[model samples]
Target: MNVTGWQRDALLAVAEVVVLAVILVMALLGNGLVLVVLLRRRRHHNPLHLFMLNLCLADLVVALFQVLPQLVWDAKGRFPGPDFLCRLVKYLQVLGMFASSYMIVAMTVDRHYAICCPLQAHRSGATQRWNTFILLAWGLSLLLSLPQVFIFSRSEVAPGVYECWGNFAESWGLKAYVTWMTLAVFILPVVIITVCQPGPAASSAFCCPLPKAPTARGGEVSAAMSKTVRMTLVIVLVYSLCWAPFFSVQLWAAWDPDPPQNGAVFTLLMLLASLNSCTNPWIYSAFSSIQLYGKLINILCLVCLIQTLYFILYM
Candidate 1:
């Protein structure tokens, strides 16, 4: 528990540095490929594609601005260069985290309407509505995370060290904010998204819930339904399982007197959250079936997510 021992934190710090560096490499390369493909393909006009492309772009920023600095700061016990840089990183981290969560929910909603409200979904104005929805999601994310900028102030805690997510050690309001932020950022999003997923209806929406194999008449119903179910289950399961404990731990930290035992528990929380980044992309790659669009989606998602996960871990 004593982080005072140089050797104890040093080795772990070195590992963090290496891992974060690797993560940045993967993120930049993967997302860059995705962004290029998305732009050149002229697919950004599609609502889903538009949202996804922007999501990748946002996560790309997250990797560079958040993950890279987190490991370096942790390793060195302070950030190098200007104090503003530390604040900038932390602020962007909050922004990206919130934006990613919102985008996921938005994706779920888009799919839900496409299936559950198919008639309206394919109407002439559907495309325009989708674009508006994408804008709303981005705007909302920006607004939601703006408070972070106001909250963070760069501080030099030692001769050469700077801290950003600091001073929350005393303010009870900050703890409460963390508690709520965790719930809003992680808990509620997963629930709403899972429930709103566009999977095939089981036997009973009213009676006995029975699994029904989708009956398709040359449409994407069967395939889309199956993918929806598989993806919904996988994404929700992983996100909830990994993040629930992290949020719980934060809640505990907010309310309880004990610090995390050896910081490993918190680090574990970080690891699980980070897992979402890499694993989510792979999930898309594996789950999207054989559609032509699968490859692009997988590449974009993987690139963005892997980088995002790195920061979640190192941050």
Candidate 2:
């Protein structure tokens, strides 16, 4: 390649590294704080809080397994680990994605049950039901992500150079894999979330009729439940917005003969999909108490200010 081409490639790598670094830090800090706070409060009995805790845990896994490894790969210009590490990382990366996606779906389904079927939701053993949902979410994620271990491995791409890559059948393997991932990870979960999110104006034609609260205390309970439902809805919307471009690009690159694999826009979209992890904690904070929201805002401002100063001084 020419000097200009080499320079552009180096610049893009640097940009990717910087972006991933920022995402990794934000995701870690945001999710870590949420986890700590929730655990300290010892509110696992609240099914919503239990889901939030697991969601944060899943986001942390994405930061560590998915984004961190990608950052390292970008900085090094290749995978810098053994075949085992490569396979493990790939499995955990997809595992985190699946866990995060299905956790949201499970949470939404819980809300749907509470709002639409109050009698069942308030029945005995509801906690057991929630626990079952959480277990299924994690179990399915583990099962689905096992394919990554078989698919990705360290391989010699050149005479002397090795990198982590996927082994696919010659003709249709990649296309099928990407399509299945998009369907399982993105499309199906989105459809489930959309159907579960009850509208404010519940018509019999669309959502199940919402039950009325019987007393003032029950009204307050309903309001709190509504807040959580709203929070879950925002999470679902943000997840879709952030991940749609990523899966779309993956599908296009898999199927299109002349895909824009090196296009700046597509690359940026994929990288910024990690921003969903960063935004999730803030979304939860926003829907939480005012005091918690204030604290989170302070933390976020401090992070942003530090990042800005570092860029100004070093970049």
Candidate 3:
């Protein structure tokens, strides 16, 4: 059977919408659960837990602002709203990307400081320092995303047809913008995470050592620190894996005159980038205590079951 071009495009659009919808639901459920568990805990003051909370918030932003809006745009086949909405959505989409990337960097750097500079980690005003890091991560994200507001607007791309579009300079503008975004959002953060992560031996020695004392408290602390380090590493690894291809594709499309914009492989890779938001909560839950993991598994299963039924009936 031969499929027409329009039919193929329709299939692609449907696939994209389904993928985004799944990503949005998983991100909301997983991160929402993580947020609730963190908030309910008496030890919410723990620096690692606080960072995880912020990370979940960042993932929620991605789900709500980035994935959700894109899903709508895909379904409608155009941007649907006023000029203000167009700009606002563009701003938030980039903001989510920045926040998610930097939050992980901040978390990794904190762990590095704790393991490499134990004295500084335990010094007075540690809580304030951690708060400062969190504030800086979000502050930078907000500040950096301002460009989206000015660059993107509801524009008349065709006669009597308007869509949310970016205004870039004729020749060099798009290339420059994409290059800068790739650097700011992905490249630089990966460099920081790489530098901050210690080797396995060093991490093991700093985070967990052979039991010198028979006390359970000492063992518990060692185990907790080790788990925290491992968890942070996993999150960073997953983030890099998920986003690297997206940024690479963006760069390629921007620089190459005849890029593979319609390539299925490229499109799928870009779509899968948003899966990072969905994976963070699960990674944290897996590393957490058995009680926490059990709680999350139950809710996660329920959400999946409900979503499955909804898709079968409606989608």
Candidate 4:
């Protein structure tokens, strides 16, 4: 069947909304499950699990406030709320992104110290200190996102169609801001994670199989630490791949304000970036045990179904 340009555009818009909605659902459910399971488990107060909880919380913030507003704007073609609400939404969204990135970095650093420098890790990573790390991560994220409060404003895109947009005074300012954000939130964190990854011998510090077994302590600890290193490395890889396109496009838009229109492509890129929030839980599940691996595989199959449907109907 053939479709006209308008029809095709309408389909694409619908696909964007549906895809974003699916992402929100998956992110909420998967991260919520992580929170719930960790909270209900007997060892919930441990530093490592608490750090995972922080990551889940950050992903939830992105799903609920960040992606949800974008989804609404895409579906409605305008900001549905007042100027103040728009500013708040934009601020929260950026804060969530910063928080998620920093949370991952903190996780990497914590593991690196724990595995590579046991005595130092024991001294520096006490319960109070871990609390301070969590606090500092959230505090710095909010502080860094403060500029969004001043930079975003509700602007009229068409006659009576208001949308939230950057209110930078100059093009250079916008470019600089986006460049800094890209570096701080994406590039620098990935580099830090890469550098902090433990080598094979360091893995022996904290190895244990995901499943409980009466195995030799040394071998188990080595295997577990190796898996942990692999898992975090994979996370950083996925995060970079998912976010690079969106940041690249941002830099391009900053360079050329009147860039050529490719709305569908932009939507696809945004969807890929949002998928990062939905992936961490699945990554954890994959490295955990056979049971979780099976369940995560099923979830992945469903996600593939949704992506296929969107491409078939809209592209």
The clash count of every prediction, one per candidate, is 1, 0, 0, 2
The stretch of ten residues in a row with the least summed lDDT in candidate 1 is: 202-211
Q: Stretches of candidate 2 above 4 Å error? A: 200-213, 290-315
Tens digit of lDDT per residue, candidate 3, span 1-315?
346767877888899999999999889988988898888884646898899899999999999999999999999999999999999999999999999999999999888877666655677467987888999999999999999999999999999999999998678899999999999999999988987886766566555343343655867876887888889889988998999999899999999999988766878788888999999989988887525457767877999999999999999
Q: lDDT winner among the candidates? A: 3
TM-score of each: 0.76, 0.90, 0.88, 0.82
Best to worst by TM-score, what's the order?
2, 3, 4, 1
Task: Give model 1's clash tally.
Answer: 1
Q: Each candidate's lDDT (Cα)?
A: 0.64, 0.87, 0.88, 0.81
lDDT of 4 by residue, 1-315 (tens): 346777878888899899999999889878877777777763646666678789989999999999899899889967888889988998999998999999888888877876666555566656876777788889989999998989888897779777787877875888799889989888898888777777765456443323344646878877877787788888888888988988887778777868644577865775787888999888876776424445556778999999999999999
Q: What's the residue-level lDDT of 267 in candidate 2?
A: 84
Q: In model 1, where do residues sit more than 4 Å from their true spots? A: 1-4, 43-46, 156-162, 165-170, 199-217, 288-315
Cα RMSDs, all models:
8.2, 4.2, 4.7, 7.6
lDDT of 1 by residue, 1-315 (tens): 566666766765676677667766665655555566567866435554565567667667667666767767767766665657755676777777777677777777776666565555667477776777678777877787767665777776777555664555466876878877887788788777867765345222312232444544636665666666577567667767756776777777778778664474465455345434433444444564324345657767998999999989999
Total colliding residue pairs, candidate 4: 2
